[model samples]
Target chain A: MAIIDLNNVSKSYVSGFLMRKKKAVSNISFKVGNGEILGIIGANGAGKSTIIKMIQGFIRPDKGDILIDNNKPFDPASRIKMGYLPENPYFYTNLTAVELLRFSTSASGMPKQLADKRIKTLLETVDLYPHRKQRLKTYSKGMTQRAGICFALVHDPQVVVLDEPMSGLDPLGRKMVLDLILDLKAQGKTILFCSHILNDVERVCDRVAVMDKGHLRKVFTREDLGNQTMEEVFLHTIEERSEC
Target chain B: MLNKVLSLSILTFLEGVRDRAIFGIGLFALAMMSVTLVVLGFFMRELDKVAVDINLSAISLAGLLVTFFLSINLMAKDIDKRTIYCVMSKPFSRAQYVWGKYIGILFIISTAFAVLTFCSSLTIVIAKMQYTNWFKAFSWIEYFKAVYASFLMFVVLNAFIIFFSSITSSSFLTLLFSICTYIAGQTIEEVVIYLKSANGQEAQLSEFIQKMIDILQYILPNLSVFDLKVQASHAIHLPLDYLLAITGYAAIYSGILMIAASLMFSRRELP
Candidate 1:
């Protein structure tokens, strides 16, 4: 069964005094079934983040319906079992990583004793145990990213959504995140992620969805990829869509 | 839901208390309190009035500074820095965000007020000890009444700040609107009274202008009503009924403003 579904979702942003409407995503629809890793590959303006925001209910779709656990995206109940990490995740600079996680646990309604155990384990998993007491303002980019991942999983959410989780990381940092994603997948978690790094997507995704100019061009599965490089597949897909 | 809001509120308060601006404001209030000693030394005849006026003005000035500088930043920084994205993605609604943030700000404002009031009252005591004869008519109860009224005024001001924070896209705009609201709220009653007196005279003011003033008076908060420092300084009789009435006025006005803010914020799209 699908844990997350977006049926014909459409969203547009109006900008400037003239209110010139720009279509961010148009009638895009897809779903991530239970225990599946779906990687969305898109360019900067291809509406990947827009879709994530709608699914997270930070904004509403101009048309269509979004269901997380068959509940509307805006419903707090819909987000109860979900975790999200935004691209370049920013947090309260004044708060330490441990404090931030404590806040997250409370917001997710986790019991205190359980949250304490989970928080320690998650912090250790991200190799941030030593820096847990430092303010987020004092953290390096890699440290902050690791702390962000821990925050997302602090409550042991069943479905995790990560937007550009690999951004601004060195090879070692990227590898750490890649390994974390694999670990979550191994634990039978449903993961939906968007990344510009096609190689990482190819390496980790069960099925890869290519988006271009607010449209979902294709969703390529592992069997379909065979030995073809994701770069070639992604380029060919974009070319084919442009020609059509 | 309450737990989530409380967590956010506590987080916001923690962040606010750690801000350098808040520290600076606190130091400034402290410095102002110290200056009251010197200012009172210069006034021999009206020592009691000088002490109350200087101390109360210090607290009010400190509050205004915090409202414009610190409180506005607390609300706008989350949105500006995109930190709001992570918080909003939680199992909480945008209305909860607004209320949580508002509650946090209230905590900060109240904390600051309490500290400053304590310092001011201490200075007043020192001055009273120095000039025992001058404070023969002074009353501590009346002084606390003024402080309580000032607290209510700030509650109303912070509500206005939250309302503007929800509607405006930029911090500068929020500050601008809040300043305008403060000025209008502080003086609109006097403006209406002026217009009424002019109306009694022959054709001094136009009906349209009078009508506009009347409308403004009805909408804008009468912040002047919260100013009991003069009466407090003089130890005048302030009826309990009047205080209760103004307190009710503040509650109803701030309640409406908060509801409006929550409604506007719930519809706001995060960038």
Candidate 2:
């Protein structure tokens, strides 16, 4: 069964100061099935983050429907079962990693005992146990991103959405994040991610969605994507869309 | 759902604690309050003259510094630091996020008021020594009224900033609007005084301005109403009916501003 669905959804934003109208995502639609890792690739301003924001309900779209496991995705209640890691995640810099995780748990309403256990295990899972008590302001970019992932998974939600999760990292840090995604997949979790790093997405995603000009350009599994690179596939699809 | 709001409030409180800049701000505010003692000790003959003015003025000034300047800048710091997006993405509603932030910032303002009031009253004690019996403390009741009044003033000010911060993309506009609110709130009495006087040219203009001002006087939160410094300094007795009515007015005004702020926040989009 599909775990995530966007049917005929559209979003437009009116610029606050300029009063200019912008159609961020126009009639966009796709799905991610249970236990599937779907990767989305697009350039900046391609409505990648806008779609994520809509799915997270930070901003409601103007029209159509979005369902997470057949439930309203934009409702606050549906968020309890979903975990999202934003690109360039922000933290209370003065807080220790442990404290941030604890704060997230309290806000998410996870039981205190379970919250503690999860924090402990997740810190170790991310290899952040050594810096758990250090202030986040002192952490490097990679370390902060790791802490971001830890907070996202603190509730052990059924669906995990990560936007550019591996962007700010060295090779080893990227490897660690890629391994984390695989680990989550191994445990039967449904993962949705968007990336500019095509190689990273190619290695982990079971299926891939390419978005361009506020629409889904194509959906392909690893085999259909094949040894042909993401750029070549993206080029072919954009050319097809333009011609049609 | 409400539990999330409560928990976020606590987190907001803790986040304020973590800022550490507020501690330095508190100390500076308290220092000014204590400086009044030095000035009062220098002019021991006019002790009561200085004590009443200094103590009451210190509360408003300290509260103005914190609530006017600090509260307006608080959200700016979170935005500059990009920490706002994380909080917004949680299961928390925008109303909860904004109210939590407002309440947390208010906690800091209240603390600043308390410390400043304490230091100011201590000056009152030392200054009142020469005026009254040997080394006897004058009275805390008057100072208590000042503190309570200042607390209300800060709440309105905090709400004012939070409301503007929601709709304004520019911190400069937000700060300017807060200052305008402050000036408008302070001049309401003078505006009313000019309203009733019978004159020809100026009065016609004044009355038109006065009518508009009268509408603003009730519509905006009145900083002057919460200001009991007149009685505190002049040792004049304030009417109980007027004071209570003003407090009730503040409560209603603050509620409307906060509800409007919540509505604006609900429609905000985060990057």
Best by TM-score: 1
Could you tell me every candidate's TM-score relative to the true structure?
0.96, 0.90
Per-residue error for B35 in candidate 2, Å, reads 1.9
Candidate 1: stretches off by over 4 Å? B199-218
Q: Model 1, range A1-244, lDDT digits (tens) per residue? A: 9988989989999999999999999888898999999999988999999999988988899999999989888888888889999889988888999899998999999999999999998888878898888889998887888888888889889999999898778898899899999999999999999999998998899999899999988998988987889999999999999999
Per-residue accuracy of model 2 over B1-271 as CA lDDT, tens digit each: 6677776666666666566666766677667667766776577364665677776776677677666556765675565555776776567777887887887787777667767766777767766664574224334565577567767877787788888988876677788898898898888776667765556334555556767877776776668877777665545555677657767876777778889998987877654
Worst 10 residues of 1 chain A by lDDT: A164-173
- Candidate 2 accuracy as lDDT: 0.78
Candidate 2 chain A: minimum summed lDDT over ten consecutive residues — where?
A71-80
Candidate 2: where are CA atoms >4 Å away? A15-18, A239-244, B76-82, B129-138, B199-216, B238-243
DockQ of each: 0.81, 0.58
Where does model 2 sit among the CAPRI classes?
medium
- Tell me, what's the RMSD of every candidate? 2.2, 3.2
Indicate the residue-level lDDT of B218 in model 1. 56
In Å, what is the interface RMSD of model 2? 1.9
